[model samples]
Target: MSDTAREGDAEGSGVSEGASGRTDAHESGAERTAASDESSTDAREPPRLDGWPLVGNTVEFVRDPFGFYDRLESRGDAVRYSVAGDEFCTFFDPDYVEQILVAENERFRKAQILRDSAAGFAEQGLLLTEGEVWRDQRVRIQPAFTPEKIRGYADAMVTYADRLCDNLADGEVVDVGDAMSELTLKILAKSLFDVDVAGRRAVVREATAALNDRGDASGASAFLPDWVPTPKNRRFERAMSDFESMVDDLIAERRTGDESEYDDLLSILLDAEGPDGTTMSEAEVRDQMVTFLFAGHETTSLALTYAWHLLGRNPDELERLRAELDAELGDRRATMADLPDLPYTDRVLKETLRLYPPAYVIFREPTEDVRVGPYHVREGTNLTLPVFEIHRDDRFYDDPDEFRPDRWRDDFESELPDYAYFPFGGGPRHCIGMRFATAELRLVLATMARELAFEPTYDGDPDLTMAATLRPENPLEMRVERR
Candidate 1:
């Protein structure tokens, strides 16, 4: 890891030294005074990265977001950089991350960029809503994710995994990413809506691909105006329209059926009431469905995809995983009851999440001027919690980039800082489906490892793309070998 203190002291670095250090070179005197009075401390502005005129750091960031954030880590814990004309402060220190996500969470709101991007699909859902709306939605949706409810979904998860494994032929080359996406989507459909999405898989896949293209920061669509007739934007609109139609069909079908016959998440949303004794509106229900459908399946599939990729490259790890599965679940499918004895399987998933977090970054904006460490951040300044960069930081883990599941075998997590390994994020706004996703990952991995092994069809690392989720830039092809 880079020396945090030494980086701040480097010549020409924008980071201030102490509470009494001078303000950022660009900060107006009046603005600096207001920040000092708000915090009643001599907090200076964080370090700033120099970029080209007008475009700023947008080009570099668009070119390679992971590399861009990695470069920022060498500047200081808190570094300011711009994308296009918009400025954002990224926090690298775990303590500051905790403050932003947990300690002083109320002082920040979900970043506007995220809201704008998601507005096309899930505007009123738990992912984008704020204040009363978010709180109520979370309250209404909490019951479906309780420990008992999640455990109940394990059978369906394992069943779907077995189905996928059975469909694959020995020595057949497969697009592992697509296969995982299909498996998780099926698992999610059954667990969340109590329906089969076998027929709608193509639509979901198309819509998800379009969403990724539209939301990807590395693409030109990200910087263009919404009204602009960009090719990607046009495709996104068509895909969303089809996707919304599918959601409407699901909702309409459920509305016409006996509500008491179903006990999945869709039914919960349909029957839930707020403190005011009102149920969600039609549009709100659609938003919730879209939110869960996208968020729930997409992240878990990516986790499984990356896990397969990593395990395929590491034969020793693959053998270890198979040994654990064979010992715990020999010739039988995995169940929730067997999770405790499958510690190695759990560690493999954890290691994969650390290396390739689906939600790479969490964006938040301060609601008011606040002091973060020795830095004075103004209200509405974008705060980025780079989960991807932090996960791979050498400061937190030894050989951070290597895919070694056994690293999690000891008290490593117990000794790590709170926000150092937050793959699902932290605080009040963390991923609500965390438990569900983890359970799905472990069960699917166990079932697949028990019956088969994967061998990579390509060489080196598959190129990675960043958007709302971290995914491979190309199809991750692998050969399916029956164990």
Candidate 2:
């Protein structure tokens, strides 16, 4: 089902994986000495592996990247895999990441694969756009996520978080993941639109979930053009239609002057002006709203999922977090003004994101022939950096798999290199809502930690899944007990 061609060897350039243990750039010609295989430092090729036939390693990849990475790293870091008739590779090495996001960024832009693939849902929003458009949108829209604006959203963020905690009865089993999703959606709606969007949350959630399905691009759905007729196409269309309809209604309602209208992302986008002084149109506003909604609602919730699961297993970290909150809030509430003081809470979030970055591959295309790490990428080639694998590398992190927040505590702060822990991505095109997402996360975490504690409901080992976002394969069934 998933493609697994001879992914190890790249186009007759035989990168032999042998017992001799040489895994690095294989030299082939003059004036180009291959990268030395630093055995003591790293031996993994990149993050890619050569797969078989037309299917490449898609099937293997969809199953479990962690396991796949373990095997690939055992052989070498960078392994080449073919997909969709293209020679694409996934990279876990930080040097490659730096090349893609920083050093050679001007030459590499977001690959067209994601842009065209995601065309089903939304087109050319912040995520898919390239070059000038992305630059302009980011510049105009970034100011809204300034610390001051995030601070403004904090009170409402705390309020919704506490309300979520309050609803958690001592003995009831709850899905913390789903609860956080809903909580964030509400917070976004109220703080941005000044209206409670509980009525519209489900349709939005369902539509969003559809966008995450890798299956849409697989099976029968893959055969059809994005606009063509098919189940996946229909699903994509309906979701897009519903999301836009909601935005249109909100905009119309805002035009008529709802007394409740407040200054949130929607308002900020609508009011944002490019250097040329052109404000975003209603359609642009809608796209930006969904983009922020996808980011604001989904990523923060998934981060919480990983954080909760890790904390549940680590009593020491849990107790430390509780102590931090108790000393700061003293059973009151996580206030906007108090955000500056919660250092440990921020540490937990950073560590969670470091361990389980919500974004998978940050893609870019080469504008010119360039070297990512060891691979000499020609122009028009697409490059992807797997943030998930890189974050867990022992090189950047000590005992990488272990859930230790203290890794980010002392010298680790100064030690964190650029592109090392890019949960929000990097470059000029990095997420504009980074500050906002952090603000939302802190609010929800503090409020929930004060009142509710989640105990996972799984009987055996925890399950991990990589759909649109990395999460527990099943709904996070957990007992939500009030403290």
On a 0 to 1 TM-score scale, where does candidate 1 land against the true structure? 0.91
Error in Å for residue 337 of model 1: 1.1
Candidate No. with top TM-score: 1
**Runs with alpha carbons beyond 4 Å of true place in candidate 1:** 1-41
Q: What clash count does candidate 2 reach?
A: 27
The alpha-carbon lDDT assigned to residue 10 of candidate 2 equals 15
Please give, for residues 1-483, the per-residue lDDT of candidate 1 as tens digits.
101111111111221221112222112322433443455256789989999998889999988876888799999899998886777999998877766665556678998777666658778888888887888788888778877888999999999899888999999999999999999999999999988999998888988998898888888568776667788778888988898899999998988988899888998788899989999998899889988999999999999999999999999999999988888877887888888799898889889999998998889998887887678887887889898888998988999999989988668775776678878765567667877887889999998887887799999888888876888988999999997
Best by lDDT: 1
TM-score, prediction 2 = 0.84
Query: How do the predictions measure up, each by TM-score?
Result: 0.91, 0.84
Give all candidates' CA lDDT scores: 0.81, 0.66
